[model samples]
Target: MKMVIVDKANEGKKLFRYIRTLAPSMKNGEIFMSIRKGKIKINNRIEDQGYILKNGDVVKIFFPDEIIKKYTDNDRNKYRSIDSNIDVIFEDKDIIVVNKPAGILVHPDRREFKKNLVESVKAYLYKKNEFKPGDYFTPSPCHRLDTNTSGLIIFAKTHFALQKISTLFRERNGDKLYLALVFGKISSSILISSSIDASENKENKVAVKEAHIHNFIPEKSKFIEENPTLSATYVRPLKYDSRLSLVEINLWTGKKHQIRASLAAALHPLIGERKYYTSQSLSLSQMLNVSNYYLHCYKLKINGYEEFKAPIPKKFSQILSEMFKIDAAKL
Candidate 1:
């Protein structure tokens, strides 16, 4: 018999749900038959499939050793090992925050089996003896950052922390500040209020539409009509050269590619943004020697928590110094 102990992650979940994680390759019919034939027991007693697991609960499986091995084998081998140079910004018993570099995916996708930030966080925790296979909860990112957008990514070390952080983001109680280098000089602060809808095209894209028709609506009528998926960004110009502007963006609503799409619609596409702004002449890589998009999540603040800041990347600083001829350290 193989024994398992419920941890905080799997606590409060249904027995079947926990079992699926343990034996993902096993069929539902096989699991049902095993339970019906007294092949599973909870705390030394046979429990129904709907049994609610709690912390410290014990589970016993009476399957052949080979079958159990097939079910419990760690799939970590399927992922590539991340670079050893990952940066840990903060860590505690409940959560960890890391500085995710640009060009690394935050999570795994079917298109790529390569290592991602989440897997890297798990591996980091493992080396510290804070995580292990079959633990009740594995450290996981509470939110995401686009592969090219570098900045602070939070990971929950415990399931409780995960739930709490997830709720905080869902309630929009967190503040996220991004810094971007755009193509044109923005003279003043402007609020970009628009409803963002998913593009009808197969490729993942978003369309931003202002609430009312321009000129037809009175200036006072600019109060944004409520939209279920309304996205708002407050852009404040920090510094600008004749050709490029550095702007600090306060993202009030999080949507897929909201910042990139919104800024592009406002005629200030982010430098090196190939998807939203396709102008070949505006390519920063060709003119300014910058290859990647110039957007970074520099700061994040959550309710009841102190603000966190990620230092601007060196390459970003290089572009600022080269193009604007200003000290990036000050910005």
Candidate 2:
């Protein structure tokens, strides 16, 4: 008999899947038959294949050494060379918050990019021995950020945390603040509400239409298009001159490119924004050497949890100083 102790990595995994990872050569019929014959036990008690594993649970498999050895490969050794380059903002037993830099993907989009935020985070925990190889469950991110957008993002260290944090995001029970540098000076706070249709281009681009308010009817407003998602953003100028302005945004609704598209409709596209850039904004970007939009998720607060903030990037600060002639540190 061979014994394995369930660690944090395997903590919420099912017994059947975990066993398959351990002994890859075992056929499906053989595994089910083994479980039925009491060939596998958890904590010295016979359990079904569907049993969910918990940390420190001892699993006993009455399999021959040759059966285990011939099939299982070195899954851990393949990840040994991965090193984390993440900037940690907060960490706890259940979750980790990181400052993802601009240009790195939170998750890989294609096969060409091997290094990403998820791999880096796993490697960080792997070094601490909190995670092990050949486990059914892996550490996962609770949210995502655009590849060119730099900001704070959260990763759940355990299965329980992943479920809870994901629920919070889905319910929109958290507050998120974004900082953006845009063209034109604005005086007062404005709320931009529009309908965004992403079905046309397979999410590569989105079309925005304004929500029209009717004077003929009571104070009711509706989107003109059918089945398009409605999105709203509250934009307030923080500091601005005649030519440029720095703004803070409270995204009332989360949609793909809600901020970027909404602002472009308002004729104040973000500096260096590619997908939603205006001619004037594009000209300014060329003058300022800005390649991508300056949009950062500066602050986030879960409804019941403490607020977390990520500092503005150095490149963002430099642009503010040179364009607006205002000190970013003071803002």
Candidate 3:
């Protein structure tokens, strides 16, 4: 028998969703069966899986001891701890924004499960006594940046803030600006607006297909038809030489590899992007002696709320100095 109490963070959430977070090892079928068999009760009354939880509600579960043990034992200790010197860009009662460095993933995945930005945020909050283990809601990132893309990432400190910020991002109510160095000289500004279809190939790479009309729908994941979404990128050349051009990218719509794919389709890919466009002429690793790509989210703004900006990374400045004889600090 296990007893739990609803807290502020989980209030107004469905019973099934809260249970899954509590016991991740239990399958959906098992959870549904437990509800049907009266093995789970809310406020001493048998409730359906869709019942909305409220603060002060007592939840009781009756499960086998072995099943409970399976979920309780986690391998968090196996992962390496992140550095303590996390750069917090902004913080208020509702949210915390951090300046994430390059080569650090925003979240953990099966391929890379060790040090990640999310855990680092959690640890930072824990050290400040802002996060407690028994709290109903855990602070989490509202949006994500690519692993090699360095920039500002926001973390919601409360459940209300989380829901609000997530809705803002989903509705495209925010402005996101990035800086990138691409091959070839671009003299004029251009706008690339098209429908993007994305799917995982056999090599586990995200293959992107762009079209004026919606097409190329995959069976397992319908990337275009389901969402009916279109991606838009506005690019302006900031500096240009014979070989490379520094550009400012305004991302109007967010999608998987939208900027990288759009630029590559235009025959000017980012300088260090391997998956989108591998430059054979100038190896980024050989020149800069770094494996990270050269795309940075320099600025972000949420309407009527807050704005953030992150400084360009040192390696990016090094490339600019070596090629264009320009100082990044002056930009």
Leading candidate by lDDT: 2
Q: How far off is residue 285 in model 1, in Å? A: 5.7
Best by TM-score: 1
Which residue pairs clash in candidate 1? none
Off by over 4 Å in 2: 1-74, 200-203, 211-229
Global local distance difference test of model 3: 0.75
* TM-score (all chains, Cα) for each model: 0.79, 0.74, 0.78
Off by over 4 Å in 1: 3-62, 66-84, 211-228, 278-285
**Candidates ranked by lDDT:** 2, 1, 3
lDDT of 3 by residue, 1-331 (tens): 7889997777888988777756654679998999888899999898999999999899988877766665544412221244446889889999988989888888866584567887787667766777644345667899878888888888998888888888887776787888888877887777665666667676435444563321232331233244456676778888997767899887767788888888777667788777777564246444755455699888889975666888889989888888788888776
Q: Which 10-residue span in candidate 2 carries the lowest summed lDDT?
A: 212-221
Error (Å) of candidate 3 at residue 23 is: 6.5
Question: Over the stretch 1-331, how does candidate 2's per-residue lDDT look in tens digits?
Answer: 7798998767878889888766644688888888878898899898999999999999988878776554444445545777666799998988988988888888856668556898888778877877655444567888778888888899988767887887887666776789999888766677777788866574588888974322232211233132235676778889888877889987766788888888888888898988887899899889878888888998888865688999889999888887778776676
RMSD of each: 4.9, 6.5, 6.3
